[model samples]
Target: MSQQRIGDRYELVEELSHGGMGDVWRGYDAVLDRPVAVKLVRQQSVTSPELAEEFAKRFRREARITARIQHSGVPQVYDAVLDDSLERLFLVMELVDGVPLSAYLRNGRPLPVAWAAAVVAQVATVLSYAHDVPAIHRDLKPGNILVARDGTVKVLDFGIAAILRTDVTKLTATGTPIGTYQYMAPEQVRGGRITPQTDLYALGCVLHELLSGRLLFTADSEYAIMFQHVNAAPQPLRELRADVPPPLEELVLHLLRKAPEARPADVQEVYERLRPYLPPPGSEPAPNEAGPDGVPDPTGLFRNPYAPRSRARAEQRPPAGEGQPAAQPVPAPVPGALREEIKEAYAHADALLDEERFAQAAEVLGGVVERAARALGPESRQVLELRTHRAAIQLLGGDYRSALPEFDSLADAYGRTAGPGSEQARACRAQAARCRAELGQVTEALAALEDLLALVRSVDGDVSEEAVELRRDIGMLLLAQGRTIESRHILEPLYDDLCVVFGPDDELTVEIAEALALIRLGLDASSP
Candidate 1:
């Protein structure tokens, strides 16, 4: 309801979708002044007081687990709140503006080879990260995957599926099957032990349908489809779609293998197999390539891949004498008359910044920076300060593409003027790394962070707040990259120090504690 508010902060704007677990609503966060998706738990799932309490705990656990997945392909979980009455459950998440994959699956023919492969490859990358969280998505269907306007494929309902797993297991009074029948793995139908392989099998079902433009196993009744999943052999992709490449077709069949172990070893292997079908960097996209609902080309990343992070790929920092950008000599100063003008411009920019006009503040500061560089000196601390403020404003404005190079240049400038290990240089490096992370250059971000962390520890010592914060950041970055063991190695000690320095009530301390708990959960799940 448009007039309804959940948790006294999120006002429901419009219902997005409704399923067994809950109704997803496009909501407005009044306090934050931003759009959010609010998933309200299905009232029927918590009809009794005892069941309501149980569901609340399950909801919180799953919400936290889902939030731990830091991939861009997974929507960020913002908050989970239960109403004072305990009659309602709400999960606030990033509002994804996209078209469900099911929209394209409705077409009567196969998608372009590159297009189909691109989607599957992205999904595989996401699965690799999800599996590391050790959270198996019980349901993987076209409906749960969305192709965002930017061509990023987002997997939805990771936690929601887990929440509803038990409820769906009870045989219905009518003997009707639950879940999307066409996408159900044979193991799922038989109520076998669900694992990461279960998701792979469902992915295979989805991939088959994408290539054939039809269900993997067609039947008139839901029960018939379930039976076919357990017994029927799928026809080869080429038989239905002659244009499907042999290698691609073979990969699809491998993913659809009847036994869990019979499938590819992991999503990584699935991605590698799909790589041959993906367009090479700088290659042209398929004709008429706009996806369903005017979504951007998903193949763009494959066609023009981000430059590899040299250091991270090598797993070693460059020697002191190598790989550094050449330094430039500072420019000579301009006339003294311009000094007052530059100061005035900076004042004006500061006023704009205080008003939250970040872009305009950056623009105002940019002129001051140029004039100050000329009137004072390019290497002057004043000039560097002006440039730094402008770069920070660009970042705050969400102009990441513009901010990244600025921060990089600022890092070099600060290093030259203030020494590489100076606080100013370290701050610039940290900001640049954050920019890289925001731009989806995770490897570069991690490498930059690690280098900065080492420098910070040498200058500030391990227990210094700066070093502690950098450690926390580095650990989170590692977690985001699915390097769970490395993340734990960094986070555990950082959390202990944070508790000692800032006390257990500190936000960063609490966050690191939660992260460590998630890491333990993954470890516990994998143990015998």
Candidate 2:
């Protein structure tokens, strides 16, 4: 059989593992020329077409949110792919060279106290960063944790649980909960709200199993295991292993508390509690203090925090920009096949936009923009238009970080191709400013908009649509910044212009009038 390809870029090499949600493959990225782990999730039994669409939206949203987490412990998400039918989903991620924590549990032998503590400490640090992103790992378990060759603990599937839980009963058609029974928090078993504490409870279960060589709770059936988690009291680690430290046992109990509120306040607190067990900075392990056979020492990080790579390893590292796919040189004239591909890409992107799939639309356009730029010259109108459309779609999808730079680049390109005073240039500049405002850089955004508003007025006059929109944006930004007087100064005149140009009953005119009325009420009330 021919090799399976995803998004026409990732080529599956072999199956790695299979789980309830999907099958993971060892894949190769044809574009980047690197190894990637591709998770193929097949949803074949959707009850209705409407439900499938909702699932696709939630899956894409959660995947984007998960990618926002910047940390070494969580594998970087490279891409998310959904087929036209929205049934076969693919998540391409950084392929980790590591062994799952479950491998160490094969012989039912407990790990050394320091080794187990080191692993959990690393996981806790990663969780602290993830929770700050507010991306909770609702299904954290041993199988999802990997110990890399360098002993770094990588946590997998950051947003997969939330994606599955979007409409669990309806999507799964089973009315079953969405976490591992043995490691699930009591609230999860009870169908209560999940929070960061839910992950902490799972962490406690992992630590207990690592130290005791057995699960925290066990039964023949999944329901029985869940029952033990919800209502049964846990046996203290000390009772199972006399070698367990008193404080460590106490910490485990605290994390596995029945109530979410009763667990440690957050992973940060848990990290602090485990610090006593971690190797101190600049310290070296004793001659006999080695970890399990074939397993790297987890304490190496604490012993030499942020150490530089060895000279040999550094020599093997690729220089910046090496190994990345380079754009093909453009021929004297663009090929017919390439032009056809560009046209098809644009048509597909427009259709996706009609369906309100903003992110996917942006992706579809992005897939062709690079090739179009190389073939048609970077400054060609076609390339510029494609970039502008993709940036607008990104802005609509709430990806201001990605949109801001694209808009800025498009503004400069439009000015070079069309003129500094061109409407297209001014519009791109305004969009960039709006992106800045969305990103909370209000002061800079206001300054840019004000300057652009002046430019718009000079070129198109004060009542032009561009000038009117800029004025409205500036007024609202000032109002948000608590500068009511300044906001009124800008909006009061613009409201009159809207009424004169489009009538008082026009949607834009009425919206401005309502805003002015609210500002008046505030000023009148504050006079006392």
Candidate 3:
């Protein structure tokens, strides 16, 4: 199919997947220049025009409610658009990079108990916020759950079920349930009311499958599955896997209770029950608890809740400041074989980086940096260069907290070895400021950038590329903080310098000019 543009902003690139309700596309937001997931709702075959109009209204309302979920686990809903025809509806959402939980059930191999608990606990946390919105998922299954590379769980298609289940009939024309039958609750199968408890039942199914490596019920047909959901007792998890924790199995049974009220009071209670199995804060998973191959550890979030990226080396270095000791002398040169090994490591890292495998590339360099640092003192030019490269890779991978301190240390090391005025030291300091900016330390970032800019100007003058970039950064940072007058002052001088250095037609010159123009307009509007 030809690529289609929705709402004049989201341009479909390729179809990612299709479900009963709609087709999800890997898309791009033209205005923002960012990737987005565009879900196009299938035009349902309604009997009358009024029904179609009502469906459109419900779709918009549901999309808006889903956007209010306000949890990191939910892919942010950016926009909902319906054409005047009422046949075409689209939802633009944050493009999540993750592997669906379905991918984790490799060859029916059971997941680690802690891994399963971690996934469920995170899901419960998301459900708590969603239930507070009183937004029942109606369909919670492994297919809709994503384990991000950073070990965070993301729940997808939050309100799509409600939008599609506008009618009372539980089964579609194909004789399949509205949601996946394997994970449907008894009420959902019987066309009864759906409450937050419905989601708990589904979560129970997911947990059971995660631990047992099999569905709660398997049958010859979708009808049989639905019948089992409404009538049959779920097989105890311990029956399928002896290693299953008794309390966890009990909690699953509690969630799978035939009646909604028979289940745990709320998602909070379910989370509390699962908490005993969750990794404690700042704890690391045991070697035996490693998850399936190529799958990120879902337990990492619980293990180090809100923790910063870990430094490759265990020891912390002293902070860079006045009266710091002089740089250590460089060690003897490395043997030819080791030098070649270092070259190969760099080559491999670069190849990984070219493929956008940033985390792996960072890891590859990290493995070699320490060995190289030991051979050539930590302050040696070669070691500093290696550290700088790995730090840049970390920053690109969005590990700002990890990159920040490395940049700070590199700056100090470079200052001591190559002199404070050296280009290397200034660049490292500037990078540290950028990391601070990314980490939301705006005040600290601005202070650091301003100080570095002064130092850059003292060495290279106002028109130097480094000085020009620093001025632009400071101006943009001020503009972002709503300090329009201050931003204008910084940009006004920078614009003049840009025009003199690179001419008015240069891209940098035009950018600064445009920013100045916008600032002037805002200032004029706010004037008394």
Candidate 4:
């Protein structure tokens, strides 16, 4: 329904996919001017009014809990709404672009050893972080894992199992489990206590299937599969596939252990066991390493280590000169000899920036800055502010290459003149961090924001808007990097503060709310 708008903001654009739980529509947030995914829980699926109420509570809980996961593989949730009629429930989330793992299984061919291992390792890493949140992904299957074009393995439906946990229970209303039959853990079949090991068992089953091109336990009936999961032994991997390594085979069997306690201790241990199969750092894989789809090797994170390496640094001097200048430099003459008032030009540029005409704003600021620099000195406060404004505009306009150096220079200048701890210096550093994020230097951006946030908190106190804004930026950046849990921890509280200080109508308040919603839906919409 192109004309249908949910929550007075999100206009449904196209139906992305549908499942037993609900329909997922690609939507546009009219207020924020961005794309979002709207998941509408089918009212008819509720079965009864009592179940409907419970479903709402569980949906809210799972959404909030999902937001707590800090891994980059988890999508960011944007918003959750329960219609007043309680007939329909909606989750607005970041829209992820990727192919489902189910696509790989279509050919029924066992994947390459490294490829299979790479996918599992990435899932395990995500689980390692998720397990720490103590949230069990009761259902983990090929359909729930997406391989982004960038070789990023994003785990979907993180808390959705819980959201629709009653879906199965309502069907039988007796004792059918919530998870899929093939991937269900033995403990899950027995209705035993769920724990982190439950997820590890599912991971093992997924890994086995990926390596063997078959389910671990297959039978004519679902009950038989459940029985096999609880009481039957899995077939040996090496026996089924000649290429499967002993260590890997052993690791899979260990993960498939019948007892929760018997399974590998945790996801961390599973990740380590898979480590040997991973490509070494800075490695160039053989022709076979790449998938038939030509998907970039997901193992590159292990092989090349995407972390930025330290560059040798030479001693640097102050950007504002040896000392702070007491006076402004004289204005430079334009080719046409056109003279414009600096304040008027700044006002016009600011208006443009507010309207989101970032390039135009930066251009205007640039000329003013040049004239201001020549009229005043290069180190003049007015010139410095103008440069800062231009850098920020460029950054907002998505020109990271230009913004990065400008912010970097501004930071040094502010540091030299106002002291590193000064408000202006910290603000410039914060802008630089934003530039890093825009440039795809996620780790560097996070480190920079963390440092700046700490400095701002110490200097301006915790309640200051500067400190609060820094926290918001840090949360958004973490979400960008797929650290949902950490972002949730920061944004949840920051949102509350913003609401109290600036009210729910404030722009920052709405933004934080949107961010939390994105984290819930396993999406990252934090790009220019």
Best by TM-score: 3
lDDT of 2 by residue, 22-133 (tens): 8999887766555689998755446688889888898899899889889999999999999887778888999998999988777898887888899999999999999998
Candidate 3 lands at a TM-score of 0.63
Model 3 stretches astray by more than 4 angstroms: 1-3, 166-175, 310-528
Q: Against the true structure, whose lDDT is highest? A: 3
User: What is the alpha-carbon lDDT for the whole of candidate 4?
Assistant: 0.78
lDDT of 1 by residue, 1-528 (tens): 014888777768678898766789987665655668998875555667888788778878988988988899999999998887777778899999888888886766667777888888999899888899977777789889998876779998887766655535422224333356787777777766788888898889888888888889877877787778888888999998888889888988888888898999999999989988888988776565545545566787777678443232222223222343436556555556676766777787677567666765576677567767756777776788888888888889788877877776776666666556667777877887888898888997888788877777777789987788778888988898889999999999898888898899999899999999999998899999
What is residue 228's positional error in candidate 4, in angstroms?
Answer: 2.0
Residue pairs of candidate 1 with colliding backbone atoms: 334-374
**Candidate 2 wrong stretches, greater than 4 Å:** 42-45, 166-174, 286-289, 310-528
Q: Can you rank all candidates by TM-score, best first?
A: 3, 2, 4, 1
| Residue lDDT tens for model 4, 388-435 | 878877877788877877877887777766776767877887887788
> How accurate locally, in lDDT, is each candidate?
0.78, 0.84, 0.85, 0.78
Model 1 spans with C-alpha error above 4 angstroms: 167-178, 286-293, 307-528
- Angstrom error of the Cα, residue 466, model 2: value is 68
Ranking 1 against 3 by lDDT, winner: 3
